[model samples]
Each structure stands twice: as C-alpha cells, then as structure tokens.
Target chain A: MEVVNRYVATRHHVEGAPTEADFEVREETLRWAPDSGEVLVRNLYVSIDPYQLNRMKRSSASHLAVDGVLPGQRITSYAAGEVVASACAEYAAGDVVAGVLGWEEYTLFKPSPGVLMSKVDAGGGFPLSHHMSVLGTSGMTAYAGLFEVCKPVKKGEKVFVSAASGSVGNLVGQFAKLAGCYVVGCAGTTAKVDLLTDKLGFDAAFNYKEEPDLKSALARHFPDGIDICFENVGGEMLEAALANMSVHGRVALSGAIAEYTGEGRRAVPDLLEMIYKRITVRGFFAWDFLPRFAEFGVVVGGWVRDGKVKVVEDVSHGLDSVPAAFAALFRGQNVGKKLVKLA
Target chain B: MEVVNRYVATRHHVEGAPTEADFEVREETLRWAPDSGEVLVRNLYVSIDPYQLNRMKRSSASHLAVDGVLPGQRITSYAAGEVVASACAEYAAGDVVAGVLGWEEYTLFKPSPGVLMSKVDAGGGFPLSHHMSVLGTSGMTAYAGLFEVCKPVKKGEKVFVSAASGSVGNLVGQFAKLAGCYVVGCAGTTAKVDLLTDKLGFDAAFNYKEEPDLKSALARHFPDGIDICFENVGGEMLEAALANMSVHGRVALSGAIAEYTGEGRRAVPDLLEMIYKRITVRGFFAWDFLPRFAEFGVVVGGWVRDGKVKVVEDVSHGLDSVPAAFAALFRGQNVGKKLVKLA
Candidate 1:
C-alpha cells in the first residue's frame, strides 16, 4: 500500500544561526512493504539537536560534523516511533522503538543487523515522546557524560554547567545535585536562569548575557573553584571555566553549540595552567557509552519514577513547525527537550 | 669566625626574556655556628630552571611562577651540597645532602625537623654534579610526566616529544624508546634534532623552527596518528600535537617555557577537538609524583650506569657566571641539564 508522508526538509544550505526559512515542509508518497530484515515505522516524535546544524555544513576536519542534508532530502535525526510493519524477527507491529530515523511521518528502515533499531520496553508509564527526551539519546548523553567522563562529580565538589537550560546540561546539573554537589549553571536569558534555579534546583544560576565579564562572573559564583565543569557552550564560556577551575578539576567537553555554525570565536587557554593546576580535560561522544544504556536506564528510570528528575520539554506541534522549533534551539529559546510531535 | 659567601641575586625584575643584566653576583659574610637542631652546608652546585623566571615575576597566580627573587635577596634553588657543620646529629662533615637550599656558598639551614634536608646514598659511580642533572629533579620530572601522566607509553605506539633536546624531553624520549615505542620529537635547532635522533635514540626528529607548517610537519611524521604527546615547549607545537592526536590520545603537559617570560605568543588549542578525538589533555607538576621517587631512582639509575641513558650537562664555572648561565635557559641555548658549579 502507498501512504502519504509529510516531512520537513532543508530548502537550502544554512550558515550562522539557522532560521526557519532554511527549511521547507512538503508531502511525499511512499509504497510501504518491509524488505528483508527491515521495518516500517510511523515516527511519533523527532528530536531537534544542535548537531543537526553541523550536518548542514561542509567540512573536511576530523569533527563529528556529519554531512549536511542537501536540498530536497529529508533530514535524519534520533527519533522515537511505533513500528507499523516489520520483516525483521526482532521487531513486530506496534512495537515502540527509538533510534536513527528521518524527519518524516513514516519511515521504511532497512537497518543493518543489530544497528540503530532497538525495541524499547514500554513499562515506564511515561509518554512515548519521553523516549526521545529523557529516556533516549539526550538522557544517555547526560548520564554518560556526567558519571563516566567527568570523574562522576564527587559529593560536595563545586559543579558548573554552561547552557544549563538545554537538554543535556539540565540533566547534568540534576545529576550533580543528586551526587550532593554544589551546582551552578549559566544561561542566556533570565527566564532560563529562573528555570535553572527555581524549577531545575540549581544551587545558583546566572544570565551570561547580563554579566559583562564571564571570567569574573564565574569567579563570583565559583569562589571556591569549579571542581567539575560540564562544558556545552564553547568559546569564551569554556575559557572562563578553565580559568576558574580548581586544582585537579575535570571538564567534560560535551558540546560546542556556540560554534556549530563555524562562525563563533573560541577561547584560548594558557596551556601552562593545565600543568600547574593538574587539570584533566576530556571530550567525548554519547555513543561511546551506548553499551551502558541498559545500566543507565535502570538508575535514571527510577529517578524519573521517584520524581527526582524534573522532565521538561519545549515541544511544538505538527511537521510544519519543525523548522521553527529547530531554529529556536540555536537562539537559546528552548527550555528543555526540544522536539516536534507529529501524531 | 665568619666565612665569605658568594651568591647570585636578581638585580631587578625581568618582564619578558631574562637578560644577563637582570641578575648580579654579590658577596656576603655568614657567621655560621650550628645552633641546636641546625646544620650548615657548603653549596656544590645550583640548578637553573625555567620556573625561576616565574619567581622573578610580580603576581599572585597559582602557577609554578613564584615571587621573583627580590632585588637584594639571594636566589633560592634546588642545590646539592656537602655538610660542613652539624648540631642536629642527622649529618656530619663531608656528608652529601640535596634539597632546596640557597644559591650562596654557605647555607645555615635550621631545617624544621624532617623537611628539606636528606643525605644522598653515593656509589652510583656518577659525578657529584650528576646529582643536579640526571639523578635530580629534572630526571624525576621526565620519569613522572611520561609514566604517570601520559598513560605509561605503551609499546609500539607512536609518541612525540616537544623540546626533545632539553633536560626533561631528552629523558622522556629515551624512556619511550626503551618502552619500544616509535618516538618522534621536535626541537628548535638542527643540532638538537640530530642529538635527539642520534644520541637520545628517538625514531624521528624534526626541527620545528625549520618547518613552516607545524601541523603538516606532524602529519607527515604521524601518518597514522599520535597516541601520546609529551609537551614541554607549549604554543604552536602543542596545537599541532592536539590536531594530530588520535582517539583516546593522552597529552602530558610537562612545561611551557615558551610563555615563561609571560610575553611569548602561545598557540591556543581548539577545545572542541578534545571532544571529537576523545583526547585527554592533562598538565601536572613532577612533585605530584614524589612518592614514586625511589621507584624512579632505581630504573633511571640503572639506565645511566649501563650506558642506556646519556647524561648531558652544560656547566659554567664560578658564581660570577651563574646569572649568564641561568639567563641562557630562556634562549634555548643549553644542551641537557644546565647548572652552575661553585667550589
């Protein structure tokens, strides 16, 4: 049978702060019959990530910057969906799965054996979109990036998070607080700052836009020194964190959305200080910790059920609004898990 | 009775590159009588280190850069000496001791209990000056920085060392070579590069000053990827190393003499690359590994004895030449360990 699929695709290549005009929504028809070892899924929700902006650009560096989605092609992202038809023994009709899928209402995925298609267990009692939010890749990023990479955030250590209102940063702050750490976060707007402190339970929050000097701003908040820095916004913010870090501090280079457009200025650190202070700075990708997802789910799901993790979503409705919501991410307008619902 | 004492003192504060005139040789008389729990030593040698320039600076940063020697006070340095008088019963005349002492010929050390003064066990069959060179702080630095900080240099992995002709770098390259790694190093001069490959047993050596593009120079040498970088001369060399580092690569930042003067332009690294490549860039002080000094002494001592480790020292005679020899360190003119010999 043939089905009409509505999806959003990039209209043209974008540079520097992607706008809604960079995308065009259209309808397409696809004949759906699952091939061998394949499945047909109706995507319930699609994730809008900072990394998507990188995929739309051309570069030859050894960066995680994937090839950009070209004109007339539907973009790819981590998505949560319900399987409509299946040829693979691993999946059946109506099974909920979260993995790589296109930004379309329906997808026919001939996934390689044991890659990108995992049938998520459904007893969590949360909405399916939460799979794309806290229970999915973003949550794994916060879990692995915090516990595995940045030395697990010692109790009573001062922790600092840049872009603390974003999907990954918010969870990092919560996880750190759970570890009994003194947590401070920085955001771009006052409302986001309030969300971090009032709603999110950060020990302190500051609006980076209001602070004229980031170094002093970090110093003012982190008087004892930052024991762990969950670095998301790169450039000047990262440098300020480096300068204010305590002896034997650890910095997890989680993301650099500030320079995803390749147009932002980066901070230069005094490499000498790295030795004198004996700091360990490491950068990692979330997939490195995929094997531990089952291990992560057990702990994080309990937190969610116990109401320890306050889940937030800045989701928009319909396929037509995907571009606008995605654009809002770079503008720092999203409160939490930025997604698009297309049920 | 008073003994005439000669020492070197900073004439004035040095801002950038230290010149010969920034220091002066002066004479003083010390009425030395070992009081209760006090010991006196006749200085034999004084080590000239890059960190001394930091001491000459006027700042209160938590760097190795300490308060510069005031205009009139004799400089403080790590020294090896012969005990001339003792009231502490821990030492007697002719016993050799090495620790942080004065640059003056005689130092009356009322050592607080068990700190700062320790007798050296002789019979290593090396000269007394060797205590200030391969057997002293410099050797410990190379050993600890390589073994402890840079992931212990696995066999056959490609290792690169910057400032490969200097006191610490030379030893690091040798240690990596002994561990059966493909070691490459960068030096400022052709003579130093040749010394690294020929005398120090490096696999390949490049003159960074001769190369127009350090990144390409490193890429040519590291066609596969660099697993470890023993960074000493920071700035552009460090950046090039960072660009070429492989996944999970560990960079041990031992020193940054390039910026010791607080004036040299250092090449700032792209903090984002640390994440993309999963690199661990750490800076550490050699003293952090002091507990392992005995373990280090056993291995490095054997290397020096069996002609496995080549010991080199550039020494100037008399206290009058101390300022000139010490100033030459910033100029990158010294080979191996630089020291001043005082009788």
Candidate 2:
C-alpha cells in the first residue's frame, strides 16, 4: 500500500518564541509491504504539546532524553489513528490505536517490542478524542507525577499547581482533588482561572499575571504552606513555591514551560530553604510509568465514567493548523489539551 | 556552688564574611545547687562548624531548622567535657560526657530526657577529639546523605564529592569508596586535591579553583556521566554538576557553603537538564536521621576500627581562638573537621 502523507515540518530551528511562520506543510510518500512487518496508520487526531518546542530547538538538554526534531523532517508525536493496512498480526484494518504516531496524514510504523503504539477499543463508549486528551500523555503525566512521584499524600494537604489550565496541569489539579487534597492553581488569564475554579473543581484559582511578586502571591494563597506542588511553570514560580513550601514538602518537576522559550528568568531557589524544610524535588517523565499503564487506565477510566474528572480539550482542524495550535501553547491561548483533528 | 564562666559570644549579628573582631570572650556567673537538678562540667573540646555562620546572620532560613545566635549571649555548641559536680542521678563526678555543651570553661546543665547529652567512656580507646570529628554530626551527615538519601548505589557506580577535603565531604568520599564506588572529588587547592587522591583513596581529584569551567572539568573526569553527587558546595558547582549528571542521577543537597555568606552567585540549574536526566535532588539534615544515629554509629565505628576510614581533625586552642577558627572555614583554611579545645 502507498499513500501521499502531508506532515508539518519546521522550516528552520526555533530558538526563541515560535510562530506559525516557522512551520510548513511538507508531503512525502509512505509505503507498506506484506512481509515488511509494519503497519500503515491513517492519523485521525495528533497531539499538540509544549515539549515539542524543546525538540524543535537548535540544541537543548531535552535532546539527551528524546530525539531532536530536525528541520523539514516528519516529527514523531503522540496521536490516535486507525489501521489502514497491516503487515503484522497485532493490528488490522479499522482497528483504533494510540501512541507514537506522527503529525502526518499517514504513518508507516514497524512493529517492535519497544514501540509505544497500542490497540485501544473503538467501542469503549468514550469519544476517540478522549484517547488523545484525557487518556493520553496528558493524563499519564498527571497520574504518574502525582501518584508515583509524589506519593503518601495525606487528605486535606494543600496542593499547588502551576499552569493549572494547561494539559498536564489541569489533570494534576483534578487528580489531587480526587485524592482529597485542597487544590489551588494559577493561570495567566481570568478565563482560565475561572475554568479552573468553576469547572475543574480547584478550591482556589488566581491570575498569575496580576501578581507582581510571586512569592507574596504564594504566601497569600498558602498561609499554612504548600505540602505538595505540581510544578510546571518553573522559573520564578518555582522559586516562590519553594519559599512557601511546608516542611517535608514534595515537588514533582513535571515541566518548565516558562524557561522553555528562553525568555523567562531561570529559577534560583533558596538551597537553604530546601535543606531546612527537607524537601524532595524529583524530575520524571510519563513514559517512566508506562509499565503500569493498564493499572492507571483502570483507575482514571472510572473517574471519567463517574464524572469525577471533566475532560478539557481545545481542538484545531487539519495538518496546516499544527503551527498555530503549537504556537498557541506558548502564548497560553489554549485552555486545555491542544489537539489537531484531521479534516 | 558558684563559679565564673568565660564563653565565646558574637559581638553583633554578622551578615557578611566574619572576622576575629566579630567575637568576644564574655564572662558570666554560673550557679549549681543540689535542689536545682543540674550537673556542672569543665569543657574540653568544642566543635566549630561552618553552619554557625548562618546562625550568626541577623536573619536567615537556617533559623527555621535551628535556633539563631543572638548577639552577646551564651552560644550553645557541641562539646566534650568532664563532670566536676553532679546533682543529677544520671551523672556522677569524674564522668566524661560529649554532646550539647558550649564554648565555655564550665557549663551548668540540667539533664532532661530530650537533651542531646550522652555519657562517654573516658577509656573508650579513642581521643575525645574523635567524638567531635568523625563520630559527631559530620560522620552522621555523610552516612545519612550517602547511604540514606542516595541509596541503592551499585558497586562501581561513579560518585563525585565537592568540598572533598572538608568535614562531611571527606567522609562521604571515603564511605562511597568503601561502598565499592569509583569516587572522584574536588577541592580548593592542590594540597587538598593530593590529600583526596593520595591519602583518601579517591580514584581522581582536582582543584576546582584551577578549572575555568566546572561542567567541562566534571565531563572530563566522568565521561560516562556522574551517577551520584554528594553536593556540599552550592552555586556554580551545583549548576555544573546538574549539567553533567547521568540518567537517573541522585544529588544529596547537604550544605551550600558557597552561598552562606551571601557573596557567591546563586545557582540556577537548567531545569531541562534535571527533567531529561530524571534526577532526584533531596535536601536533608543529620538531625532528621537522629533516631538511627546509633545504627549508623555501629557501621561507621567498625569501618573506623578496621582502618577503612580516616579521621581528620584540626583543633585550635581556647575560647579566645573560637572566632578565628570559625572564620577560617569560609577562607578554606581548615584541613578537616574544625574544632576548638578549651583550656
């Protein structure tokens, strides 16, 4: 089988704040043979994530963990799709799957033990879009960071989440609340703040842009001190959070979107505070907990069914909108998990 | 009974690099009565540590964990002494004790269950100075930080210790070596570097003062990347270590001597590096593991007796030299554990 695949590619390495002009639609032919041991996928919905910006950079520390995205190359991404043709026994025509697909209309994937792709049920009652949003990398990141990295959380403990309206942050706030914690989140806009408190069930939400001194802002919010901080923004926010953390506080260093674009100041947390409070700051990835995916799925799936977790997603249309959707993340324009649905 | 007690006191709150002029030997009257339930002791050796500088500061985060040193007041410290008179049932005249004494000629103590004081055998076959050096807080800190915080360390794992000639750092390097690790350490001078490589059994040693770029220096020594870092010096040294760490690296944030005096630049580690490496940075105090102190003592004591570890002690004479001895720590003048023996 052969098909023309149109994918979004960076025209050049993005070193600063990315714009839609940095990306272009490039087309290539993808082929699959009967004995090639590969599956041909027609991508339905591709995930637009903030981490991709780091991969698109000219050089970055992110390259140490994941492969860098080269200019004019088909960027590998997490997406949901249907099997158009199969050269392997595990996947067949019309079977729905999710994992490491790409930003193209079609992806030729080789079946291997280490491959992230997995067959998801199409008749599972939940929309296929849920597989790309609430049950995807965003949910996995939240569950792994909260349950695995920051464990033994007691009920009524204060939990603070930065970038609370964003993909991973929103889910983290929801999960913390479900775990019987007092959740507080900070976002850039008034609408996102309202979305967090009114819709997402965050106990409190505030606009970070209005606060000049982040340290004082955190102190005002957490008078008793934050026991667990789901850190995503990083930079001065991380510094402020550390300053107001309680003794034996735990910080899951999930992401640093503030420092990713090279504009924000790097955080200089008080090392004395860390030692005096005996805090533990651990950095991890969602994939680090991939071995327990089914276990996490069983738990999170119940939340979605019981209406305990409200799925928040902002979707754009077509491969050409990938640049705008991605650039919107850095601008804080996306309300939740940003996804691009193919036309 | 009443006697005049001469003790070292800070002249004023010190906010910068301290000098001998910052301290004075103040005399006060001490009274011990049979009805008062107190014990009188003649002070011998008192520990002089770098952490005292923070206690002398007008205000600091250190005050959160330990009490601050008020100007012109008796500064409570770690010391060893011989009992002169006893009104308490737990002690008797002529008994040797080591624990929370002070830098004074004589101390009047009321023995309480929560008090840190402990009776030591005068004929224990080790000098009293050893109690203040290797068997004191320094040994406990090294043991807890290396074994407890950075745990499950495999044999042949590379370990890097900063401030390698200092009290805790020296012991950490030695303990890591005994744990079957390939250890490398950095110190301020060539003499200290030689002590690490020659006297201490470090696989390699370097004068960090001579290296223009700490990141490159670490990379050159640990081409395969550092698995464990026993960080003592913070600021730029910490930033560099994070940059060159291996996947799943562990950093025990024991102390930050560099930032104590507020002279050094604050460390701003690249968050991307920390996240991509899946590192764990934990801050701890020896007192946090006080419950296991005796357990650590048994293991470390065996190593000491078998000559698997070396005890380094640098002592000054009398309470008059307390100021110089404490100030010399920031100047990197002390060889190992700095102490002051009262006359």
Candidate 3:
C-alpha cells in the first residue's frame, strides 16, 4: 500500500524565534507491505511544543537529547493517530495509538521494543486530543518534574511555576495545588495570568511582561520565598526564582522557552546565593520517568474525569496550520496546550 | 580576670578584593566574672577562609548563611583555643576546644545547646593546628560536599575539581580518589597543579591559567565527560564543566572563590544543556551537615591517621598576620589550609 504524506518541514535552520516563513509543507510517498512488520498511522492530533524550536536549530545542546531536525525533514512530535494499516501483530487497523508521530498526515513505523509508540487504550473514556495534551507528554512531564524531581517535601510549601499557562506549566501548577502547596504562576499576558488564578486554581498569578524586575516580582508574590520552582520559561525568570528561593529550595528545569528563542538573555544566577540557600537545581524530561507513564495516566486521567484538573487546549485545523500553530507557542499566543488537528 | 585582647578587624566594608590595608589590629580590655556564665578562651589557631570576604562586604548573599562582619568588630571564625576561665560546667581551665571562636587572642562564650563549640579530645592524636584544618570545618566541608552532595555513584566515575590545591579542594581530590573515582583537577599555578597529580593522587591536573578556553581544556581532559564536578572556583570553570558534563552529572558548589573577590565573571550555564544532560547542581556549606560532624570526624580522622589521606596545612604566626593570611587566600598564595597561629 502507498499513500501521499504531506508534512511540515523547516525551510531552513531556525536560529531565532520561529515564524511561518521558517517552515514549509513538504510532500512524501510512504509504502507499506503486509509482511514488512510495520504499522501505518493516520495522524489525528499532533503536539506543538516550545522544545521543538531547539531541534529546528542548526546546532543546539538539545540535539544531544532529541534528534535534530534538518532542513525540509519530516518533524517528529508527540501525537495521536489511528492505525489505518498494520503488518505488526501488536497493532491492527482501526486501533488508536499515541507516542512519537510526525507533523504530517500519516506516519509509518516498524514496531520494536525501543519504539516510543504505544497503543492508546480504546476503553479509556476521554477525548483523543487529551492523549495529545494532558494524557500525553505534557502530563507526564508535569507529573515527573513536579512529583519526582521537585517533590513538595512539606504541606503548604510555596510553589512557583513559570510559563504557567503553557502545556506543562499549567499541569504543574494544578498538580502542586493538589499536593497542598501555595502555588503562584507567571505568564506573559494578563489573560493567561487570569486563566491561571481564576480558572486553574493557582493561588496567585502575574503577567511577567509587566514586571520591571522579575526578582522583585517574585519576592513580592512569595514573601516567604519559593520552596519549589517549576521552571519552564528560563533565562531571567530562572535567575529571579533563584534569588528568591527558600533554604534548600528545589528547582526542576522542565523547559527554557525564553532561551530557546534567543530573544531573552541566559540566566546568570548568583552562585553565592545558591550556596547560601543550598538550592538544588535538576534538569529532567518526561522520558526519564517512562516507567511511571502508566502510573501517571491512571492518576491524571481520573483527575480529568472528576473535574479535579481542567484540561485547556488550543488547537488549529489541518496540516497547513502546523507552522502557525508552532510559531504561536513562541509568542505565548496559545492559551494552553497547543495542538494541530488533521483535516 | 582581666586581659587585653588584640584582634584583626575590617577598617571599612570590603566590597571588592580584600587587601591587608582593609583590616586593622584593635585592642580591648575584657573583664571576666564567674557569675557571668561565660567561658573565656585564649585563642591558639584561627582559620582564615575565603568565604569571610563575603561577610566583610557591606552587603552580600553570604550574610544570609553566616553572620555579617561589621567594621571594627571582632570577626568570628573557626578556631581552636585553650580555656582560660570558665563559669560554665562543660568547660574548665586548660581544656582545649574548637568551633566558632573569633580571629582574636581571646574569646568569651556562654555555653548553651546552640553553641557550636565542642571539647577537643586531646587523646585524638592530632596536632592542635589539625583541628583548624583537616579535623575542622575544611575537612567537614570536603567530606560533606564530595561524599554527601556530589557522591560518586559508581566506581571509576570521572570527577573534576576546580581550585584543586585549596584547603577543601585538596581534600576533595584525595577523597574522590579513595572513592575509586578517576579524578582530574585544575589550579591557578603550575606548582598547585603539580601538587594535585604528583602529591594528591589525582589522575590528571592542569593549570587553568594556561588554558585559553576553559571549555576546550575541559573537553580535552574529560573526553568521557565529568560525572561529578566538585566546584570551588566558579565562573568560567562552572560554565565549562556544565558544557562537558556526562548524562545525570552532579555538581557540588563548595565555593566560588573566583566570583567572591569580583575577579571572575558570573557563570551563565546553558539552561538547555543542563536539561538535555540531566545535570544536578547544588550549593551547600559545611554547616548544613553539622548534625553529622562527629560521624565525619570519626571517618575522616581515621583516613588521616592511616595515611590514606594526607593533611596539608599552611600557617602564619601571630594575630598581626591575620589580615595578610586572609588576603593571601584571594591571591592563591597559600597552599592547603590557610591558618593563623596566634602568639
């Protein structure tokens, strides 16, 4: 069987903030054979993430962790799709699956033990888009980074989340609240900030753009000092958080969207302050906690079903919108988990 | 009892690199009474450390961790002394003790549960100067920072030490070697570098001053990447180490002597690299491990006795040498532990 696949590819290496001009829709032909032991997937919902910007660059430290995206190459992302055809016994036609797919109409995979792809449980009563958002890498990252890396050691611990309205940050704020923490978050826009405090159960929220000095802003919000900082937007925000951290504070580096765009300066925290405070800063990814993915799914899935955790998603239509959807993430235009849905 | 106490004190707030001119020797008459419940001690050996520079500054983050040093006031330091008179039952005349004594000829303290002072076991079979060096805070800081903070998880893990010939750095190199780690260290001078490899059992040592680019130097030395970085000299050293760290690397911020004296730029580590490599950077002081002081004393004391770890001490004579001895630390003029043996 052969199919025409339309995918979004970078027009050139994205060195700075991403725009629609930096990406293009590319065409490809994918062939599958019955005895090939491969699975063919019809992509449904593909994730638009900030971290992808790093991979699009010509050279980046991020390339060491995730495969770099070459110019005009198919972009791989955390996506949900339907297995339209399969030669592998583990997957059959009409089965839904989610893991690493592409920002294209279709994806072909040869299933193996090392494959990130996993069959989405059909019996799970939730929207397919949730698998691309809350039940996906965003949820996994938020869970692992908050619970495992920066665990709230005490009840009512002050938890500060940067880029709080972003995919993982929103979930982190909600999770921190559930763990009995005094959670405060910061976003770029007033609307996003309102969404955090009013809709997302954040104790308080602020527009980072309005603050002249991030350090003073954090000091004002967290008078007692931040106990656990879930760092998503790095650079100045990280520097500010480090300055206002409590003794033995834990900072979980989830993402650094600010630095990825090259628009913000890299954080240069006072090393002496870190020593005086005994701060522990750790960098981690959702894959680091892959063994606990299923465990997280059950707990987070239940929260979504019971309305204990609200899932906020902003999705664009068709593969052609992939460029705009991804570009919007860098601008902080997306209110929540940004996604690109197939036509 | 009446005694004239002469001590070294800062003439003014030291905001930059310290010089002998920044300090002065002042005399004061102290009258001790039995009803005062104060234990009077005649200072013997006093510790001159790099962190004290921060305390002498008008304002610094170090003030949060340690008591700030006011101009013309006696600066408290880690010292060993002989009790002259005691109104507290725990101490008596001729009893040797060590802890938070002053950089003066005499010190008076009211013994309480919160007092840092501890009686020195004369039968411990070490010189009194050793109490201010290996068996004191320097040894404790090295033990806690290496074995506790940046613990070598596996045998033969690559360990990198900066400011390798300093009091704590020297001990960390020796300890890392004993822990079965492949250790490399960087120092400012060729002599200090030679001491690391030739005398300290380090696998490799280099003069950081000779290297034009620290990142390239570290890459050449740690081709396999550093697993544990015992950072004493921060700034460029920290940034270089982060760039060349292995997956899940641990960095224990024991000291940042480079930045403390305003001689080096603040390290601005790539946040993306930290996340990609899953690095853990922690800042800590020896006081954080005060609970295990006795435990560390037993273990480290055994190593020093068995010749498994070498004790290095650099002592200056008289209270008048305090300023010069303290200033020498910033210039890297002293080897091993810098101390002032009072006359």
In angstroms and one decimal each, the interface RMSD of every candidate reads 2.6, 0.7, 0.7
Task: Show the colliding residue pairs in model 1.
Answer: A55-A68, A275-B283, A283-B275, B55-B66, B55-B67, B55-B68, B56-B68
lDDT of each: 0.83, 0.91, 0.93
Q: How many backbone clashes does candidate 3 have?
A: 0
User: What TM-score would every model get versus the actual structure?
Assistant: 0.94, 0.98, 0.98
After superposing candidate 3, which stretches have Cα over 4 Å from the reference? none
lDDT for each residue of candidate 3 in B48-152, tens digit (9 for 90 to 100): 999999999888999888889999999999999999999988889999999999999999889887778999999999999988888999999999999899989
Per-residue alpha-carbon lDDT of model 2 for A1-343, expressed as tens digits?
A: 7899999999999998899999999998888899998999999999999989899998998899889999999999999999999989999999999999899999999978777988887666789888888898999999999999987458999999999999999999999999999999999999999999999999999999999999999999999999999999889999999999999899999999999999889889899888888898989998999988888888898899999999999999989899999998999999889999995
Q: Which candidate's lDDT is highest?
A: 3
What is the iRMSD of the candidate numbered 3?
0.7
TM-score of chain A of each: 0.95, 0.99, 0.99
True contacts kept of each: 0.68, 0.80, 0.88
Candidate 1 structure quality by residue, lDDT tens digits, A1-343 = 5778887888777767899888988888867665556688899889989878767755423334344577778887888899888888878899988998878898878868445667778877887778887888889999888888886535699999999999999999998888888999999998999999998889999999999899999999998789899999888888899889888889888888887766667878877567677888888888888889898888888888898999988888877888888889988999889999988
Model 2 misplaced stretches (Cα beyond 4 Å)? B121-124
Per-residue alpha-carbon lDDT of candidate 1 for residues B1-343, written as tens digits (9 for 90 to 100):
3678887888776668888888777888877665656677899888888877767766523334344577778887888899888877678889998888877787877777435556788866778888887888889888888889886546798899998888888888998888888899988898998899888899999998889999999999999889999988788788889999887888988888887776656766776577777888888877778889888878999999898999888888777878788788888899889888888
Best by DockQ: 3
Candidate 2 chain B, which ten residues in sequence have the lowest lDDT sum?
Answer: B118-127
* Candidate 2 lDDT tens digits, B285-311: 987888888888778888888899999
After superposition, the stretches of candidate 1 with alpha carbons farther than 4 Å from their true spots are: A1-7, A26-35, A60-72, A111-114, A152-154, B31-33, B60-68, B112-117
